[model samples]
Target: MAEPTLEQLREQIDGLDEQLQGLLNKRAELAQKVADVKIATDGDAVFYRPEREAQVLRQVKARNTGPLDAETIARLFREIMSACLALEQRLKVAFLGPEGTFTQQAALKHFGHAVETISLAAIDDVFREVASGAAHYGVVPVENSTEGVINHTLDSFMESPLKICGEVDLRIHHHLMLSEHTQLDKITRIYSHQQTLAQCRKWLDTNMPRVERIAVSSNAQAARRLKDEWNAAAIAGDIAADLYDLKILHRNIEDTPDNTTRFIIIGHEEVPPSGEDKSSLLVRMKNRPGALYHVLKPFKDAGVDLTRVESRPSRSGNWSYVFFIDFEGHRDDENVQAVLAALEREALDVRLLGSYPRAVL
Candidate 1:
């Protein structure tokens, strides 16, 4: 048998493309039908189901066998689902932003581009927007690999009655950008958020030690400032640079190549277990010897894996302390229930923040 000629292969490729397009349209039409059924059953149905989407993505990744990686394949499917969900109901997402921030990137990453995203000035505002029903969900940075915990985000969780529905881990790449009018030789000052400044501390010290560094509200804000200034450059990500129409003087200026920031999805609804999930809890231990041990012993006994445990000064009193715990099991799991019951009996106060699927894409 002779190998197919270039013309023959091109014809076959076009045929496959046609078939794929038809199948995609069929899938979308079915999705609309599903949405109709959901609305008929429940008038206030949530079109975006974190657990369901996670499960679908996990299955796609697991079943993938192709030249493309699992993440790439899953992303293609994510956009499809996002489009279908938009037909059902467009999601309103709130993020910490004046626009073009990492949080905005994470929100788009998790929900896809179909969501209607609104920028809030602060983390607290993001939480409020979601809790007050102004937004269906909010995305906020919780921690960065290099900068420890975002204390403001942690504190916001203390009072907010929101649940962690999902999470996205974004690899941060900071670029030194300047406006078109700026003179490269006369760049005497740098601007960025305090955390961004810290993440690129070593890089700045070695490259531009004599230049003055100023901390701004956010990297986006810094990028905006560079639009009019001639002697200043902003260290920000690609989004901010593009948004501000600035030129990149240097790319990936962050000291650590693997710098990553973890952002969480906040919503009013409690998410069901997605098989592989993580639960977050807040516990206020009584001020006594072995108080911490009492709070954690249940998890140890139940063989539940604790992912994170951080202590914060309790707002109730000067000397009192509260712990934020994240573990690798859903609240609905038997072991998790045992742990929560134990904590309730032993701790001064215990609150379950949420049980959400682990990040898939």
Candidate 2:
């Protein structure tokens, strides 16, 4: 086959570009109409419909017949949804720490660039931001592949009344970064967030055993501080690298390659099921041997699958722990509701953190 000339390729691209533009405009028109109908008939316009989004992605995946894979197509449509949502309403989001952090990156990835994000100093700040209506939604790390559950987030849930609207699981990649003027061999100290240090424990032990490890509030902040001095490195992701004007000394420096972090989106809305659903709850049981068993009996009898169960010290009473439980199913489901009703009779307190559809990406 004869190879196409550069001019011919450019012409073909031009034609396809025009067609894509037309299709996008048509889609936007339809979206506006949909928004109008929702407002006139339902009395409110829902910019994000998780169920509709899931169906759209699933259909696209089923109908894919090109070089683009399902994941690629889905991400494209996710941006499209974000654009349409912005046309209707731009959502404000809160995430942990300063910019360039993984949690902020995950928030931007899932919510798209249209969202206005506010970086918070603490996990509790994220919860409070959403609870006080300061931000439409908040993102916080729930669990990580290596470090396990973030107990601070779980404990904050016990104090806040915000609901889990969705979730985003992001693959974490930590990098060893340094200023342009720094020499790797002469490095005498490393700076990073405590979790980042913990994540790259093996790398640090093998490569820089004698070097000092300093813990900062976040990896991004540590990277920012690296610019002021030499003989020091910071462990952070690509965002930090670019923001701090540092070079990547080593990539994927974490102990494990399968590192992942699960983040929960907290909001006031109860997101409808997108075919899959997960609900969060806080349960307090009496300080007795069989008290915990009694609380879980209803779920066992009802055949409810518990996804996660974490215990945090209850400040209300001595020796009591608040159990933060995540399970599969909406709180409104008959079985789930029954289990909760039964649990309420035996438990000190039970709070439903809203039942929402599981996030696709």
Candidate 3:
């Protein structure tokens, strides 16, 4: 048998494209039907189901066999689901920003670009917006692989009644950018968020040691400042660089190549189990010698895997401590419930922040 000619292959590709388009439209029509059914059943319905979306993405990734990688395939389907959900109701997402920040990128990644994103000045404002019903959900950075934790984010959760509905892990790439008016030889000062500066500390020390480094409210804010300054450069990411029309002086200048930041989705609703899930809890243990041991004992006994455990100073007392814990299994799971019940009897207070699907993409 002869191998197919180039013309024959092209014809086949075109036919497949047409079929894919037809199927996509049919999927969209079915999504509309689902929305109608939801509205008919409940006047107030949440179109975006985090657990359901997570499960879909997971299945997409699992079943993928390919010319395309799992992540690429999942991302394509994510946009499709996002568009479908928009037909039902567009979600309002709040993120810490002046716009063009990594938090905004994470929100778009988790919720898809179809959402109406509002950029707030601070993390607390993101929480307040979600709590006040101004936004349906909020995205805020919880921790960075390079940097230990985002203290402000943890503190905000202390007082808010919001729950973690979903999460996204974004690989951070800091770029040293400048405006068209700036001269590389005359650069005297640099601007970036404190975390960005810290992430690129080694690079900055070796290359621009003499340059003055100033920490700003956010990397996006730093990029904005460069628009009018001729002697200043900003350390930011691609989004900010593009937003401010800045030229990249250097790319991926972060000291750590695999630097990643984890952002959490905050909302009022409690997400149901998605098979593979994680739960977060804020626990205040009585100040005692074996406080830490007692707090961890329940999980150990219940055979739950603890992913993370971080301590923060409690506002309730000068010497009191509050622990933020992340563990495998949903709160609704039998093992998790037993663990929580055990903790309640011993701990001063235990607040289940949420049990959400783990990052699938």
Candidate 4:
């Protein structure tokens, strides 16, 4: 067989395009039917299921045999599902912000761009919005690969009744940016969130050691400050740089290249097992000779994998501490159940923060 002519190739592409359009429409129609069936059976129906979406994305990645990478293909499917769910109900997502914050980015990344994002000023405000039924979900920074953990977020969980339904790990890149008013040589000061400053500490020290560094509430807030401060630049991300119309003076200025922050999804309802899932537990041990040993021995006995463990000073007293832990299996699993039973016997108190699907994209 000879190579096909340009006209023949064009015709083939056109046919495939038509078929793809038809199939996409068919999928949308089926999704609408599913919504109708749900509404008929239950007056109040949930269109978004974290477990279901995780399973679908995992399968999409697993079954893929193509030129495109699995992440790219999974993202396309994510947007498609997001659009379909929007038809049923536009989910309101609240996140720590003034907009253009990384938390906002994480929320969009996890829920898809179809969600209506509510940018609250603080993490507590995010919890309030979701708790008050103003938003369907909330996203807040839990920890950073570089900076250990976010204490405010961990502390919030102690009082709030929200459950962690999903998690998103966002790769962070900091850029030293300035507006037209701020020239490279004339730059007098630098501004960023305290965490952002710490993240890019080494870069700033080497490049602009003499510049006055100011910490603000959030990176987006730092970028906002740049508009008024003619001689100041801000260290922020792509979203903030674009939102504030700042030029990137130096891109990826973080001290570490692999700096990433983990965010958690907060909602009122608990998520069911998503096959490959992780459960978080808030444990408080009775004051004893071997508190830490008793806390960890059960997982070893049950043959469960532990991911992370952090200690926070207990608000109840000056000397006590609470353990925030993440581990392999869901609460519903047999092994996990046995571990929980052992915990009840060993610890003063144990709270399952929630079992949720691990980050897929």
Candidate 5:
């Protein structure tokens, strides 16, 4: 066969791209038909059904006989779903910040880059926005690998009517960021959120014990404030550094190298079990000894694995405490339902905070 000219090869590739675009448009038309069917049948208009998408992603990952990786395939499908979802509903998401926060990055990662993300002031505001239907979903940090738990997020669950639909675990890498004009040695203060300050405590004690610490509302906010000052450096994530156009003076500055924060996706709809599931519950027990023990006994007897248990101050009555429990199983499971039923009778107030699939990440 004759060797093809570079111009001819380029033309052929362009022609293939045109065909691909045409097929994509046709596929979208079919998806619209599917949407019309769903609407006419009084069904949901969300074209990117999470359960189905998850299954597709799992299957694609499993059947990987590929030059392309599973993550790459999933990314492409996510973009396709983003286009489909836009046709179905304008995907609205709320995250904590003044932008460039880890939560904002997580919201994008979970919902994909196409979602319309809004930054709220507090984590509670994110929950409220989703609870009141102002946003389709809210993303907030639930726990950190090094910091144990985010009590505000857990405490907010007690009051909010929102349910956990999904989760995304982002590996957090804290960095010391400052403007280019900032002096290297004259660093008088280091700014970060209280949680960030706490997470990097050991590092601070060992490295810069004399640097005055100023706690801000969030890492992004700290980075935002750092833009104006020359002697101050912000301890924030790489995303914040990029957003504020700051230079990273130090990278992965947290005490732990394996730092990660798990974010929960809060919404109204219940998620079906993905076989691997986690359930959260809040139980208000009588202000007496063995009250909590009584509540947890059933799970212990049933051989159900308890992942987390925390006691938050009860707002209901005097001297009472609410126990937040996380266990391994779905609400739909018989054994899990039986345990919950048993707990309901023993506890004063019981709230099921939705069973969701354990995150693949």
Candidate 6:
């Protein structure tokens, strides 16, 4: 057989591209048909399913045997599905934001760019939006690997009637950015969110010890402040930097290299069990000796793997506390049901936050 010429290779590539485009449109048409069938059966049928999406993404990854990496391929398909889902019913996602915050990035990361995002000023606002059906879902930061739990988010859950639908883990990368008006030698102050400042504490202390550190409401707010302030820099993520058009003075300034934040998706509907899922619980026990032990004993007895347990002062009584517990199993699982039954028997008050699909990407 003769070796294929460059022209022949180009022609083959062009033919494959045409086929791919046609197949993509066919998939889209099928998605439209699925939407029609759902609407015909029920007027208010839910268009998004976190469990379904998780299973598809996992299958896409497991079925891949390609030059493209798993995560890369998974992302491409996620966007494709996101587009198709939007065709059914465009989703609205609310997140903690002034427009360019980490929570917004997390929301987009989980829901994809096809959805419309509503940026709210506070985490509670995000919760309210979802609870009121103003947004299909909300994304709020629950914890940072370096900074421990976000008590605010946990406290919000104490009163809110929302369920955890999904989870997203975003690797945080903070950059020291400056406005065009400022130069490195001229910088005299640094600004960032309180948690962000703490996350990059050692880095700031070692390099800019003399500069005054000020904490703002958010990283995006800090980035926006740099626009008019000539002698200042902001420690923010790429989304904020790009939004504010700030020049990068330094990148990845977080003290810990692997610093990541976990954001939970809040919605009105409960997520079904994906093969891999995690459940959260809020339990309040009588403030007495062995109360904590009793709370933990069930998980051990049931053989359920507890992922996290954080205590917050109960709003009801003095010295009383509510524990926010996370574990590695779906509520429908037999072992998890056993644990919940044990807690219900012993605990003064208990609430299942939700069982949700764990973060896949």
lDDT of each: 0.92, 0.86, 0.93, 0.91, 0.84, 0.93
- Which 10 consecutive residues of model 3 have the lowest summed lDDT? 41-50
- Of candidate 2, the 10-residue stretch with the lowest lDDT total is 43-52
Span of ten consecutive residues with least summed lDDT in model 4? 284-293
Error of 2 at 340 (Å): 2.0
Q: Estimate each model's TM-score.
A: 0.96, 0.93, 0.96, 0.95, 0.88, 0.96
lDDT of 6 by residue, 91-116 (tens): 99999999889999998889999999
> What is the lDDT for 95 in model 4?
95
Candidate 2: residue 112 Cα off by (Å):
0.9
Residue-level lDDT of model 2, residues 1-361, one tens digit each, is: 9999999999999999999999988888888887788888876556776566666777777788879887888789888878877776788999997988999989987888878999999998898888898898999999998899998888887667788888888999999988987877889889999988999999999988999999999999999888887888999999889877889978998999999999998988777766678888899998989877887799899999998888889989999988888999987788998999998998999988878767677
Cα shift from native, residue 113, model 3 (Å): 0.8
By the TM-score metric, which is better: model 3 or model 4? 3
lDDT of 1 by residue, 1-361 (tens): 9999999999999999999999989988998999999999998887789999999999999999989999999999999999888888899999999898999989989999999999999898998999999999999999899988888988888888898988999999999999998998998999999999999999999999999999999999999998788999999998898888999989998999999999999998889989999989999998998878987899999999998898999998878899999999999999999999999888889999999999987
Q: What is the lDDT of candidate 4?
A: 0.91
Between candidates 1 and 4, the one scoring higher on TM-score is 1
Between candidates 2 and 3, name the one with more favorable TM-score: 3
Roughly what TM-score does model 4 have, to 2 decimal places?
0.95
